[model samples]
Target: MDILMIVPASLLVFILGASIGSFINVVVYRLPAGLSVLWPPSRCPHCLNQLKAYDNVPVLGWLWLRGRCRYCKNKIAARYPVVEAVTGIIFVLVFLLFKVSILTIGYWAFCSWLLALSLIDLDTMTLPNQLTQSGLVLGLIFQIVIGFFPEGSSVGAIKHLMMGIVGAVLGLWLFDAIALLGSIALGKTAMGAGDAKLAAMMGAWLGWKYLLLAGFMACAVGALVGGVAIALSQRRFGQKIPFGPFLALGAAIALFGGEAILSVYQGLFFPVT
Candidate 1:
C-alpha cells in the first residue's frame, strides 16, 4: 500500500475524483427532479444563483465560502464537500489497490456509480434506470477495452466479459425473484425493480461469485438495520427500508475483501493436500 502511494499521481487522482463527485452531486440533485443536470450548473438552492468558478472548487470552495452562497449569502449544506471528500478517498483507495491500470479506472467508475446511486436512493428512495443502465453498458465496454491491455493479468478480457454478462443476468433474475417472493409473502412492496437493476449493475463489476457474497451481505445487513430501527422506534411497522445503501456497503466490502475470503473458503472446503 505504501509503495503505491505515488504522491504526485495520487494527489492528481484525488482532484479528479473530487471533480467527479461534484458532477455526481449535480446528477443526484437534478435527475430525481426531472431536470437537466448540465443546464443549471452549480447554484445555491435557496437563492438560485449560479456559483462562480472559485466558489465551486470541490472541498476547498466550501471551505473558502464558509459554506455560504457568495451572492446570496445563504448557508450551504455541508453535504457537498462531504461527498467530494469521501469520493476522493474512495478514488485514492482504488488507485492504491490497482495502481495505474485501465482496471483501476474501471473500478473508479464502479465506485462512483455506487456512491452516486447510494446518495440518490438515500434521499429519494428511488434508483433511476438511466444511471444503472449506463453503468452496465460502461462496465461491459471496459471489459472489451481491457483486452488490448492484458498486462499478463490472470483473468482474460473475454472470460471476464462472459462472467460479467452471466453475473448481470443472474443478478437481475435472482434479485427480482427474491423481490417477487418477498412481496407475495409480506403482501406489500418489499423491494422494487430498481434494486434488481442495481444488482445487475453491481454484477457487471463484481462478477457472479462476488455478487452473491455482496447480495448476501446486503440482505443480512439490511435486515439487521431494519430490526434495530424498529426496536428503537425509528421506523413504523411495514415501512420501507432503502436497500441501495446496504447494497453499496456490501459491494465495497466485496470489492476490497471478497478475494481473500473466497480463497480461504475454497481452501477450507476443497483442500488440496
Candidate 2:
C-alpha cells in the first residue's frame, strides 16, 4: 500500500504478466492446432529449432534477437512482442486499479483469457470451447467463492451467484436471438455458436448488468469498425467480420469502467438523486 511498495509491486506484476503472455502465445498457437501445450517446448515455427532460455524471455528476447530465429534467421512476427507488452500493461493497470485483492487476480486471469480468445478469433474466426467453456466454469466458481466471503456478502451471496447464472443465460440467449434475427434478415447464418458461448462466458464473469453494457458496447464498436472496413475496401458489404474481438473489447471496457461510465450517463440524463 505504500508508494515505495507500490512501485516494486507494479514492476513485479508487469514482469509476471509478460511471462504469462509468453505462455499464452503457446496456448494460442497449440490450442488451435490440437497440439499439447506442455509436451513440446517452444520452438521456431520456420526452423523447428527449440527456443533457448534467452530466446524465450518475453519481450526482451524478441528485441534482442531482432525478431529473427537465431538458428535459421527466419523472421518472427512482431505480434509476439506486442502480445507480451499488452499483457504487461494490462497487468499493471489491474494492480493500479484494484491493488492486492481477489478481484484483481480474478480480472487479471480474465484479461489473459480474453486476449487469447480475441487473437484466436481474429486468426481463425473461431472461439474454442476449451477456452470459453472453461472460462465460464471458472468464472462461476470464482463468483461463488467470493460470495461466501463476508466482504462479498453484504448484498447476499446467493444473489451474487444467481446474478452470474442469469448473466450467462441472458448472454447466451441474447446472442442466439440476434443470430436468428440476422439469419432471417440475411437469409443465411449470421453468427456462430462460438460467439454465443463466448457471450455466456463473459456474462459469467461480468454478471447481467455489466454484461448488457458489454453487449451494447460490442454492437456499437462492431458497427463502426464494420463500416470503416467496408469503406476502406478491406471487406465486402455482406462479408462477415469476426465479432468475438469486439465482444472481448466490450467486456474489458465493462470490467474496468462500466460502473463509472454508467454513473456519467445517469447523471447526464437524470440529473437527480
Candidate 3:
C-alpha cells in the first residue's frame, strides 16, 4: 500500500478498535452481572442517565467531557479512555505487523476478547466461560477456514486442523494438571476451571508450541506480580490472585513475537541440525 493509503487505513483501524473497545466496556460490565449486553443502552452508572451519542464517542468523548458524566458531573474512571487508547494502539500495531488480511482480523478479534477477559478477571477473579468458550469455537472455525487455503495441500490442511485440536486439549490438560497439583500441595483449590478453558481457547488460536510459550510467560509474570503484591502487603501469601490477566498478556506476546523469540531460543540451545 502507498504511504497515503497507509495513513488513512491506520487511522480507520484505530478508530474501529477504539469503537469496539467502547462496546467492550459494556461487555465487561454486563457479562459479569449476568445482564443482557444488548438491553439497557449505555448509561451513567452513578446517575442512571442514558448517554447521548456524543458522550459515547470513544476516547474523544471522554476527553471532551473531561471524564465526567454530563448529567451528574460524576467522575468517570480513567480506565474507560485508557482501554480505548490501548485498543486503538494495539490495532495500529497489529496492522503494521500483519498489514490487511484475514489473519489480522482474527488477531484483532482475539486481542479484543483477551482484553475484556483480562479486565473482568482482574475485577472479579472470574474468567467467564461465555467469552472463553465462544472464543475457542471461533478460533477453531478460523483455523478450519484458513486450513483450506492454497497455502497448503489438503493433507497439510488436515494436519493443521489436527494440531489446533491437539493444542486445545493439551492446553486444558496442562492447566488442569497444574491446578490439581497445586490443590494437593495447598490443600485447597488453586486455579479455577475458567482459566483452563481460557488456556484452551488460546491454544486453539495459537497452537501447541506457542501455547506452551504463553504458559511459561504467564507463570513468570504471574510470579513476579504475586511477589510484588506480597512485598507491598497488598496480598498475603497463598491468597488467591487471578491468573487470567497474565495468561492473556502471555498469549499476546506469543501472538506478536513468539516465532522470533522461539527461533532465538532454538539457535542458542538446540542449534541447527
Over 135-193, each residue of candidate 1 has an lDDT whose tens digit, in order, gives 99987777666764656554676777888898899889999999999999999888988
Q: List the residue pairs that clash in candidate 3.
A: none
Specify the poorest-scoring 10-residue window by lDDT in model 1. Answer: 147-156
Model 2, 55-151: lDDT tens digits are 8999999999999999999999999999998999999999899888888888898999999999999989999999999999888876886787756
Query: Model 2, which residues run further than 4 Å from truth?
Result: 151-155
Best of the candidates, lDDT: 3
lDDT winner, 1 or 2: 2
The residue-by-residue lDDT of candidate 3 on 166-255, one tens digit each, is: 889989999999999999999999999999999999999999999999999999999999999999999999999999999999999999
Looking at model 1, the pairs that clash are none
Segments in model 3 whose C-alpha atoms lie over 4 Å from true places: 150-156
- Please give the RMSD to the true structure for each candidate, in Å: 2.3, 1.5, 1.4
TM-score, cand. 1: 0.93
TM-score of each: 0.93, 0.96, 0.96
